[model samples]
Target chain A: MIENLKEIKKDELLSEVKKYADAKARFVTAVCNDLGDKLEVTYYFNASPGMEMSALRIAVGKDEEVPSLTGIYLTAVLIENEMKETFGLKVKDIAIDFGGHMFLAQDSPVLPMLKEKKEAAGEKGGE
Target chain B: MAPRTIAPFGPQHPVLPEPIQLKITYEDEKVVDVLPAIGYGHRGIEKACELNEYPKNIYLCERICGICSCIHGITYCEVVERLWPVEIPPRAKFLRTIWSEMSRTHSHLLWLGLLADAFGFESMFMQFWRIREKVLDLLEMTAGQRVTQSISVIGGVRRDLNGEQKKKCIEVLKEVRKESEALIGVLANDYTVKARTVGKGVLSKDQAIALGCAGPTLRASGVCEDCRMQKYQAYGDLEFEPIVETAGDSYARAVVRARETLQAIDLQLEALGKLPAGDINVSVKGNPPANEAIFRSEQPRGEVFYYAKGNGTRNLERLRVRTPTYANIPSLLVMLPGCELADVPIIALSIDPCISCTER
Candidate 1:
């Protein structure tokens, strides 16, 4: 229960993130947690140059896809691809999609970090 | 249109001895686009952290990056301490600050050595590393280990610095400063060194911030943002400013690191002079309370972000680490596309890519 963590809908991620970008707040990184029923993806930003920081917490359904922030911040490509590769969470239209091959090897277990790990997602996901 | 060819740069290369392959599209000599493939060294440390008890994770986190291990361990402990709402003694905070600065000094020297090696300056590389050995000796003398000190613990640091060790450390640091200045002067005045790095891999201030560059990479681009500005640990007790360079090129990055190596020494001297006297460690018991926390600490390369959610049990529900190298990779990707193919190594090395930390 950290203070200054704003709860927002998944659809608002882009617009809300744009506000941070407009405010010139640095795009820190996005963290995703598997909360059993849904994923709680939080976007963290340093609201001020010093210590003041804030996070936007959004709950996405287990199978839902979150829009990519790369459209607003080009650096989102790496972390977004990581969220796709490691968590097996869906991030659409990543500016530079590694086709989910950015990190994991071909023979590696799929979504090994996800709580409900799966091995068949990539063979099913578009290559 | 000139024909474009895509070439694989490395999971292994002479310049970068790490496992990061940059599949670069090149048109003649200039890079068209780059796609970096990592995880060759990924060990899934976050998942491992979840399996371990909260208190035992101090060592596990320290192994995230061998070069800057102390800060990772310290950051993890600090974040967990926040969860516990516990206050360590004043002396522990001071010890942590001294060790953290020492880690920074050694890590920056290591990076400068690597950068020197990238430019084929073998003698300079050895010289930089030779001075780095003194800083490492200070760590070994105080904490029992050179690279991965593992001094940080959940409640406080595991070791204390005696008066003899502190006095000797100060003397050694002064010598280290003198030796480093001789080489840093060469780096500043060497024409061949400047030609290779002066205008190479420039990331402007706005591009740097939008791309989310951290540490010297961001500061080199003229952004004055350092997590130490947050005044965590004993940092508030010291008076210093983050070193910034405006060119945002490879040379500026190198200069920032070289200057920071000196600044870190000054910081250690200040911390040692103002050493607070108190208990080093307080006994910590029980598991972290069931709550979430977000912690940020400035490491050698950049900022490290840690998110921990405790379940009131021994094991954490989630422990996510966003390392500096991981953040810097995106900026690397952006920096590579427009540069010459031959400049890739020094340009990429400018960000001080740490594959182990990035993958973890």
Candidate 2:
């Protein structure tokens, strides 16, 4: 439900994100507010252009990652792992037991995303 | 203590439509561990979007999913429009809404037919698909293309719904409504369907929400998380509620989708009746600003997320699409364990795994 997206300065956003000490609550509040929800403003982070920017995603309601609710947001681990794989951003402590090599195959299709970006830049003569 | 036997389910199976191999470690019939090996159909569509212009990318996006092509194209157009911020005409919005619901009806019917086939109910499958033919005929009549309509554009839709076409759509919807009601009666009251689907592959409300499940899958699990509730296009003006079922099992999912098909038919009729007379396409001016926007739309299977990054150019810098089947895959994996081998097809079909959409 990302109704509105506001791009803020990286440093200021990181400082805002630090305000919410609890990682789970902080993540939820940041996502909710980013999607134009009237939730209590907690924390914000300025993600890097290609890396952090791609990892930036918001999931509302029960999908938010909190240890209290374990199995409900199971796909959040995959989403977070996908972010880590594609953009090199870490999601702190997530993932129950890595599905191992089987899950590794999911990352295979994603390599092209990062590779193509570099290849396109090279084609443009290091633009 | 016994060593676990590892067995590969399939990269290709006679039953499964998509090529997904599951490396299942089994202690006899019980699956101790499952390793899903995907990436057989990855086509780099998102990367290709960077090479194509915004308008042409709509066609490319439509190709992402044959069943939900209109939604994909609409989503791509909306993402580009978000960067530009142009107002779509009410007439166009209404027409788009109608088309969207029509697509939904056909998709649900198609899935229902497949589910019936999975359950080994060939007669039911044939009947459901025979009913679905009416929907396909309606689509062909209106869009002039059955699968990839390419009817949607950036500012608005490509074609206008004329008076005669509107009448035809209404008539077709009326026929579909009658046929679908009969089909629904068979699905609901029929003993064979209930015996096969009920109490199978149950994902509770908490599990559904936690897994980021969307569309009928989440709805069946009692989570009222329909993207249409956000009122995109003419959905804001329309009156409908998200179909919900408390069971959270395969039966519930089937019921949710079946009910949704009926609701879609009703919505299409309402849209056609309230078809406004106005311009179809709005002229977009200048290059899109360097900004990013996330566009979420309710596809036939579930929610489709499209992230578009514009850099004041005809070509989009980045485009990321997250299909519902990808989200639902985790739930499928969890449900697969502890189920009998005979029930595998039904459980898989319950989520309506559209691998092409997911792999794209």
- Taking chain A by itself, what TM-score does each prediction score? 0.87, 0.30
Leading candidate by TM-score: 1
| Candidate 1 per-residue lDDT over residues B264-287, each given as its tens digit | 999999999999988998898988
Indicate which candidate wins on lDDT.
1
Question: Candidate 1: which stretches are off by over 4 Å?
Answer: A118-127
lDDT of 2 by residue, B158-201 (tens): 88777787787788788888988887888787887888888888
Interface Cα RMSD in Å, per prediction: 1.5, 9.6
Task: Please report the interface RMSD of model 1 to 1 decimal.
Answer: 1.5
The DockQ assigned to candidate 1 is: 0.66
lDDT of 1 by residue, A37-97 (tens): 7887888887535557888889888689899999998877878887887777788888988
What lDDT score is found at residue A25 in candidate 2? 20
